[model samples]
Target: MAGRQTRGRQRIPIQFIESQDDMYATFSKRRLGLYKKASELSTLCGVDIGLIIFSPTGNPYSFFSPGAEAIMERYRNPDQPVSGIPQFIDDHSRTQLVQLNQALDEVLEMKEQIKDREKQLDEADGIRPKGWWEHVPVESLNANQVLTWTTWFENVRTQIRTRKEELRNGAGTSAAPGSTR
Candidate 1:
């Protein structure tokens, strides 16, 4: 611990960064953190994890536990058969993200068909399109629709972070050191 900080650490108050530069900087750092976290969760649970996030500038990023192709595959088309084992990856973030970027792009693309249907739903029927949370682009959604989608995204992010913390704390308390090879 010679190079480590002498002070203890605590979680900071969460708020949106107002400055564009600061926001971008934080986004880059936190994006890396999300990768670290997903890797940790995959290792801890011995399960494959797939995560996709779009940057403040709309660039997409993904993290997958080697087994994410099936996920990206399924996302490309859920009706398409999913066939693979859940294989946890070590540190393959960069390579895996590059390999799956096309699928990520497809998932992010604005669906013209859905856009027209969403209009009809909002104007006439008033029923939110089911599963829009998955890949519906904001360009097709109204302010209220976007707000609801964002709220759901934030809630999901909070839950993922909370679950990661719980797993970390649980492992820390055990002092098992189970990997002493």
Candidate 2:
């Protein structure tokens, strides 16, 4: 059997290794090959791929394309590992706020029209308009109206300030705020 016209180099079929020792060796080699391919693909295509591999033996290996860590550092928890996804719920929330504000503007305009009609009715009846404060433009209102708006504007400003604070705190750290990358 020692190559006396016998099989010298038998070709093992390309199948998943089942034996523990063979599996481990194949896993290690294949893992390295995969990472090499990933690196090559990133370099050639100018793409970024974040890869995390855990061996059957519980060994962990990771590969990240260039600027991957820096990219992940932004907008992610510094202490936590990052996946290749963006936390976009906040963006959706901002869009919803904008839509809600537009809807609110429409509602306010309707309310102003109703108030105008009420004023006209009061004048026809020789009654003084219900309140003098209703005459001002929405943009140029007094402290009481400002106070009323404070309920809405205050929450928006607080949310903005909180995000700003988070950005400031996350800068330069692994928790760095990502810039839509």
Candidate 3:
């Protein structure tokens, strides 16, 4: 009898697969595995399991060991006292609510931090915390005042550029060896 030889499966790296088709295939296989695990867990423990999945294509897939309605009802009313089997649903709901509240608090703190940063920026610019329109009252400024401010800023910018050019030229000339007057 001739000996039979079998090829072993190749090991792939754990990083992201670049190919879209490969990624989609992996997603499908993993989703199936997840469902299988959920089923096995529910069956072995004799407990209700609800699983909801959203695919990359935005399609939703679900599996409920007992029924969707029963799981959802328990989720909706966490505080409602239940005797047998579905108490896990209430615990999950409470956990979710606590996480949601914590997330909300974090968002509010972020908003306040942003406001503080904005106020700091305004102070750095030597401007009031109020909006530009509110502080300046553009309608109140006559054409002369506007023109004067514009001309002043333009002159200031021109002077700054001129000084920078002069300094660059002076540095270059001074740094050169054997330079005459």
Per-residue accuracy of model 1 over 1-181 as CA lDDT, tens digit each:
5795644565757988788998997799889999988876765565557888998899999887755665566567867543434223333543565557657657666576678788887786545455645566668899998788789778778866876787887744332332221
Cα error of candidate 3 at position 68, Å: 0.9
lDDT of 2 at 75: 31
lDDT of 2 by residue, 1-181 (tens): 5755745556779977789997987788789899879866865565556788999989888887544444466536667654333435333433564566579879999999999999998788675544444565678978887898778667767866877787798854333343221
Which regions in candidate 2 have their CA more than 4 angstroms from the true location?
Answer: 1-16, 71-181
Decide which is better by TM-score, 1 or 2: 1
Best by the lDDT measure: 3
Per-model lDDT? 0.67, 0.68, 0.73
Error of 1 at 179 (Å): 53
After superposition on all C-alphas, the RMSD of every candidate to the true structure, in Å, is 27.9, 30.8, 22.9
lDDT (10s digit) by residue, model 3, range 1-181: 9888745567778998888898888789889999889866865575668999987778899987666876787688868866555556545654664566579879999999999999998788785355444567767889998898688668767866776787888854332432222
Q: How accurate is candidate 3 locally (lDDT)?
A: 0.73
Task: Give the lDDT of residue 171 in candidate 3.
Answer: 50
TM-score of model 1 (CA atoms): 0.36
Q: Provide the TM-score for each candidate, comma-separated.
A: 0.36, 0.33, 0.38
Error of 3 at 40 (Å): 0.7
